[model samples]
Target: MHILVVDDESVIREGLARILEGDSFTVDAAKNGHAAIELLQQKQFDLIITDLKMPGMSGFEVLNAVKILQPDTPVIMITGFATVETAVEAMKNGTVDYIVKPFTPEQILEKVHLALEQKKSTVEDIVVKKEIDCHHGFDEFVGESREMQKVYRRIIQVAATDSTVLITGESGTGKEVAARAIHKHSSRRDQPFVAVDCTALAENLLESELFGHVKGSFTGAMQTKMGLLMVADGGTLFLDEVSNISLSTQAKLLRVLQERQVTPIGGTQPVSFNIHLVAATNRSLKAMVAEGKFREDLFFRLNIIPLELPPLRERKGDIPLLIRHFMNKFVEEVGKDVRGISPDAMHFLENYSYPGNVRELVNTIERAVVLCEGDVIQKENLELGEAAEVCSTGFDGFVPTNAEALKEMKRHIRDRSVENVEKAFVIQALKRNNWNISRAAEETGMLRPNFQTMLKRLGISVKDYFGR
Candidate 1:
């Protein structure tokens, strides 16, 4: 946690810093509200302690600035003459707590914890209200099934808290989308949402990309760089395929999460970070932990708020809704005349078990929409990549009551079957040209920055790619 102490009195300013530092918080002292505002612009702090009556800028001014500058940040007010009206005024001005000048050490610490806890609650209330306020799911994600309703309810319940979320599901199950929705509905919605694919990058560069490094930390070190932890300060960091992170990097990450401080490589000082973590993985982290591949401690730390996504096969009732959603999307996207799926094609789709889940189904719909001659997508237009077994009951698998699953399944064959195919494609392009990034970017018709961003998201470091 990072805290800013602002007071015209030197004793009060420095004393608070010392007190917070002892509590394991990174503290910065500002002589007045003006200096506090300046520091606020340069860095992110979890809490701000400002005296109500400052020489240059009053605490009221600082409170207003904080509300504008970092609205989510909590501010505590301090004054010598504490009165009920003054306290109400301070609270009205957005001070989480009001304290008198002669406050004891216990009072300060108690108020600090209480205020921070309230801040967490405030964030949850704001986010949860925003999500449930609509009383509906996002337009992009369509599911009216009971299972999906449960998922939606879970998102609503958990989106409000700063708890580290561990989203587990198979590939193509929209894990990242769920993460994004959680962020969108949270207090940090306006902040940057950085997504990193753990499987895309090599082991060595992952830390530097995440925790950052100082210049000359290693050979070919060019300039000092800010890590994603700093960049994501006061916001959420989504780690995709987190199971792929190496054990060594996992140890470093565990320290950061535990301490809330990140020391750049070759740098002596540890930078304070206030970031929410939301990690997703297709692989079983528990199994990996049992096998001694994943760190048990790190696994336990990340499993604070577990959210498991149900596969499409298990949510067969939602197939029709999903198909229609995609149908409308692709209809406008491809500018095709295709209106909807034929009865036979819909039956074929409903019967098939989508191994790859929603992603494969969408890919199939996109292809079918393009190939369809008329308004309706015919069964053959589906190209029914694979056939599903039929039960005598009909569309259902085997049970007559649940027999809706038994119809002849039309397999959804998508070209990008591999989850990391895009990452691999970029890697292949880089390798084909001997890792000449600029050349690869030009050949691939992507800007250099875009290519580099893709690499960063995939965690692909050119230096690491060449066995650096």
Candidate 2:
């Protein structure tokens, strides 16, 4: 550890440096606060020992400078004139401890060790708290794969700005979770976070819900209601499954995005709003725009910052981490004694494809925790259903007249079966990802070029799957 000694007297400064250096600490001596401040700006110190009364700048000034520059470093005040009030003042100014002048070597050493230990404890506490916050604050997104790391980086990058974000992913792939994470990390974190499910309400009701309504705007509009846009003023408004919004509502949403103003159904004046918009969708807004089903202008406005979340299948390496997270969560919630999953059960879970993504994994673990009778969760505790079944049906009742014919027939059957399975696998991945070739390739854990090569070999046209 490195320490800085600031004392106007040469003998005192040199003595403190020698004592600390003898104890295996690198020491730097400064005649006054200005020199100490200069040294602080140039290098980092683990601790600062400054005399309370100095020539030009006092120890209080040094303490204040240390607080501004390196608040984590502990400061110890030493002085010839020591009193209860001075000690109290030093403590209040953020000094770790104070020592009187003409002190013994043992006294100085004991105070330095105690201050360093306290600083270590404080730092460790902060680190542990940050780790806990990262898990719970980010909604328990337990993954460290390259794909997840990319998503994390993107979320952080966009969260610093007010740019509109469009999150695209399959259902249950945590689009809303990503939106919440963005909001949590943004400047408006302390403000409200209003989430609206666009698929939940009808066109008129959704409009009223978003744009608010004056009293008597419609048959059931008995009272004036504040819209989510107004509710999320100075905060964030998350629109979940924005692709389900009607074309007319889409036009109004575009206006809101463009003008930052909202007009109620029966009100005349427009209510201005300052809100961060984050929209999520499982469907393709680009395709919808091409088909005229969605407004192209609105799509462009919402697509300023696009974040595509990779499916769970694409980052299978993170499955074990996610499983452990879910297991801990469900075990606590269900009040079960389930401590772990059997090796066989864990292997099955890791290999089984999760079509519904993380949400499905969460459900599976919850169910297993509830059904597990012993301390460990076995394969029988999991209810994967049809997803767990492996195809093993063999040709039956087929007899050939000769050995050569039988051999040829078997070869043809094997080749046909392999081709069918491969085609089905590719098609399923494509279907799951809305026919996006890149996404399909990622979901199947294949490189884009390799996936495209397979598509060509299989004679599969991506355009054919569009709008399906």
Candidate 3:
């Protein structure tokens, strides 16, 4: 840990530095707040301990400067003239802890440890400073893949401005989740987050929903209605599935983006708006534009910040980590005693192709957590795809011509279908007999030898059903 100790008194600053450095912490001492600010501008520190009463810049001023320099860095305020109001003010200014001078070394070290614990690094190795202020949002996402890292960096870049963001990804890839992250990290997080699914409403009603209508504007317009744009004023407006929006509505949306004004249906005056627009889509807006389905002008406006979430299949290495996260979450949410999953089950889940991506994986884990009877989830507890449907885990060196691939595809489908049926039959039989192979074979009217043979062929073993 790197610590910066700032004090007008040379003895206190040097003594604190010696104590921290004695414990193997990297220490730097600043004579005053101005010198401390100069050091902060030069480099980063994990924690800052500043005297409340300094020669030039007070500790409160130092705290504010530190916030602008490194918002993640924790600050500890110390002084001999500590009062109740000063302590309260210290905490209100983002100081991790306040301490009166003439204290023991243990108290200083303890506060320093706690302050350093709160520093969450957004990037490793390289230190970065930016003017945009944002906090909290990326914790929900659980992955360290290169693509996800890039996504995090992109969100940080666009969150500072009011630029329109367009998130493109497949179903269940967490497009809305990404949008929420951007909003939470943006300056408009404290305000409302209004999400409008462009495909959720009829063409006529969509405009009314986006722009407020005066009393008796349409047949069903019983009273004045405040549109989502007005509701999201001084906040963020997320438009989901923008590719499915009607062209007429798209044109009105374009005007809203350009003019920052909305004219409700059957209304006279245009209502001005100040909102950050974030749009998401599962379909390719670019492709729709080429085909003359989506408006080209609106596409450019919404595409100012484009973020694409990768499918689970492409990032298979992250499956195990995601599974563990879901398992821990479901364990707490469902009040289950499950602590872990069997290696066989974990391996099976890791290898299975997730066609529905992260959303599908979450549902799969939720089901498994609900069905799990023991402390560890087994392979039998999981049913990844529909009816155990199988797909290629990867193209392992086998390449077929387009004309010749149909037969192979059919063969795979038929083989998987048959295997699914057989697996289901054996699983039902075992479940009925409490997973006893001999009795399960008897109940199924099959010889024990044949039953055990099928079990071995299907990679099913007694250890999977019961404790090994």
Candidate 4:
């Protein structure tokens, strides 16, 4: 651990530094807040201990600067005279710990340890941050693969801006999830996030759905209804499958986006809406523009921040995370005790190209969970697609295609470990049995302790399985 110690008293600084160093911690000393800030800018420290009152710059100034510059780093406040008001103010300024004069070495070390642990836990939780539990979060969108990480980074960068975003991807590559992610991370997150599927309704209905219509605007328009755009004012309006909207509706949408006002059909005046527009489509808007099916100007308007989500095949490294997620989801959905997928089943999943991307994989896991009977989900339960031919063997020497070689390599890696697959199965089984270890073990043909061992091996505990 790296620590920064700031104190005007040379003895106090040296004492703390020596104690922390004895605990195998790298320590940096600063005579005051200015020196601390200089050191901070030069190097990253896990923890910072500073005197409350300092020369040049007060500790409060340092705390505020750290909050902006390095919010993740924990700060501990130390002072010779401790007051309730000062301590409260220190905490409010984001001090992780407070130390009084004449403190023991163990006391300082203990606070440092606790502060580091808290920071770590907080960071870890942010890694798995969720938007609203529809499973869209920074963590839920899985992929360490460069392509997916690039998408994530781009989303983070663009979410802070108010520019309209047009997301284009193949069907089921999580366009909606990406849209939700952008909305969740944006400044408009506090307001309603309304989604409208352009293809789900007719042209006339879509027009009214976007812009509120009068009571007698058309047939069956019995009541004056507020459209999605008006309802989502000051928030986000997600138009999914946006390319499916007719040219007439596209023109109307373009007008609203360009003018920042929605005029209801049969209404004389336009209703102004302060909204962020995020449109997504499985169809290529550029191609549609070239085909003259979609307006070119509208395409350019919505494409201010273009984000494309790669298909599952391109980010197959995320398959395991997605599989684990779906397994947890299915166990809750089906109320089953099935442990997880078998080795062969996992190989099939890893090698098979998911044309429907994450959506198809989710469905496959759900189905497998429902069909699985034993403690462990076997190959028979998977009901998965055909494994892409990994190795094409002719009579003698065969030249392997690139696609085949890649598939073979993935299959070999997946086949090397059934341990992960088994844990997923066990989690499913525990969920099915309502997290009863004995029942889960009985259902999976493993002993109680052995099942616990598996849980430990999988980095899961019974309390977690049972939601304790």
Model 1: per-residue lDDT, tens digit, 246-357?
9899999999999999998878999998888999999889989988999999999999999998878666657766777788888999999876666557655755666668
Stretches of candidate 1 above 4 Å error? 1-136, 387-468
* TM-score, every prediction: 0.57, 0.60, 0.61, 0.60
Could you tell me which 10 consecutive residues in candidate 1 have the lowest summed lDDT? 410-419
Model 4: pairs clashing at backbone N, Cα or C within 3 Å: 336-432, 337-429, 337-432, 338-429, 339-375, 339-425, 339-426, 340-425, 375-444
lDDT string, candidate 2, 33-134, tens digits: 999999999999999999888888988999999999998999999866546468668898799899987888889899999999999999999899767645
Q: Could you give the C-alpha RMSD of every candidate to the true structure, in order shown?
A: 21.4, 13.4, 10.3, 11.2
- In terms of TM-score, how similar is model 4 to the real structure? 0.60
Q: Global CA lDDT of candidate 3, please?
A: 0.81
Clashing pairs in 2: none
User: Candidate 4, which segments miss by more than 4 Å at Cα?
Assistant: 1-139, 384-468
How do all the candidates rank in terms of lDDT, highest first?
2, 3, 1, 4
Winner by TM-score between candidate 4 and candidate 1: 4
- Residue 361's lDDT within candidate 3 is 85
Which scores better on TM-score, 1 or 2? 2
Which candidate, 2 or 3, would have the higher lDDT against the true structure? Answer: 2
Candidate 2 whole-model C-alpha lDDT, 0 to 1: 0.84
Error of 2 at 213 (Å): 0.9
